[model samples]
Target: MSSSEPRPESGPTVPSVLTWGTWAAVVLVAAQLVLGILMLSGSWSLIEAHAGLGYAGTLAAVLAAVSAVVWKRRGGSAGVMAHAVAMPVLMIIQIGLGSAGVKWVHVVLGVLILIGLIGLPMSLRSARRQSL
Candidate 1:
């Protein structure tokens, strides 16, 4: 605690690279949810063209989840781990609903996924702060 010793930093620390990457994935997943809802409601037939978009979002989420796992292993954040798990499961549920011809399920899941996506970053911040 002496001045000659290393001082504790003040203010909030910047998020880690993995944290930022995870946030980006969450944003993309939110976008995917919106697009999926539009597609299911027949408001957007461009779904076919954007099929790869969902896949890309899924891949990003998977990568984010993997990053979260690594971060958690390094004693990072529980929020990150939860985000990693929730997002992929939600993505799978969305896919299953779409395939089952259950448009309403897709719609509901889309909204829920969007909520979860937005929550991910907040949760990460909260977790990091609490851990610190």
Candidate 2:
């Protein structure tokens, strides 16, 4: 290799803009949780707001999962992709319970979804670093 010759390009220096999907999922889910808690505590209100945001998070999760799958096919990690898919599935169950007013299970699933949302992004970041 001579100084005048072009060198091969290095790997990604910046993360993908697709990360917004992960962040959107996390933020929407967190907001939904807060809304649910407020409704339960009888202080804050808006069941409709919670439901709407819950659905938004649900869609975001699916989108994020798709992004992860694409990323994985491109030689990224599966853990993050798995988590992205898992969260929405769990959230849907939570929503169903809430819709049917199956109190206890709905609350339980909400807790799990919150945990998943938090963990998914963290796992993704770690996996991305390892891939890099």
Candidate 3:
């Protein structure tokens, strides 16, 4: 630990890319929710846009899960792995509920998914901060 030596930088890496993907998914979901709320207000219309964004969130969730696998394989952290993996599963269920027109289920799943999506990134940050 000499003054001339460089300190290990804290930044994004291959595994950490999962966090980025999670963030993207979270943004997409949040946008869709906002648009839906506006639609309900009778002041806006974005049903098509909201439906389309669902696919993007799904894709991001898949990437996030893959990233979690990479993190685990690289011996990063197992603590947050389950949360990372759950993102896509939750999204898939949400998609089904939406498609089936199960409004109650769809709404509940959306809330749950949003919670998990938001939590996944936080857990990622925590994992990074608590280096294994």
Q: What TM-score would every model get versus the actual structure?
A: 0.72, 0.82, 0.82
RMSD of each: 4.2, 4.3, 3.9
Sort by lDDT, top down from the best: 3, 2, 1
- Runs of candidate 1 with Cα error greater than 4 angstroms are 1-17, 33-41
Q: Rank the candidates by TM-score, best first.
A: 2, 3, 1
Which stretches of model 3 miss by more than 4 angstroms?
1-14, 42-45
Report the CA-based lDDT of candidate 2 relative to the real structure: 0.75
> What residue pairs clash in candidate 1, if any at all?
none
Per-residue alpha-carbon lDDT of candidate 3 for residues 33-81, written as tens digits (9 for 90 to 100): 7776676677445767877888898899899888888777766567677
For residues 1-132, write the lDDT of model 2, one tens digit per residue: 775433344222213544777788789988888888888889545889988998998888877877777776765666667787788788788889989999788888888888878887678667655544
- The pairs that clash in candidate 3 are none
- Candidate no. 2 TM-score: 0.82
lDDT of each: 0.67, 0.75, 0.76
Which stretches of model 2 miss by more than 4 angstroms? Answer: 1-18, 43-45
Model 2 residue 51 lDDT? 88
lDDT (tens digit, per residue) of candidate 1 on 38-126? 66677677675445555666676677677777767766666568776778778777777866878787778767776776777777777
Q: After superposition, how far is residue 18 of candidate 1 from its true place, in Å?
A: 3.2
Model 1 residue 127 CA deviation (Å) reads 3.0
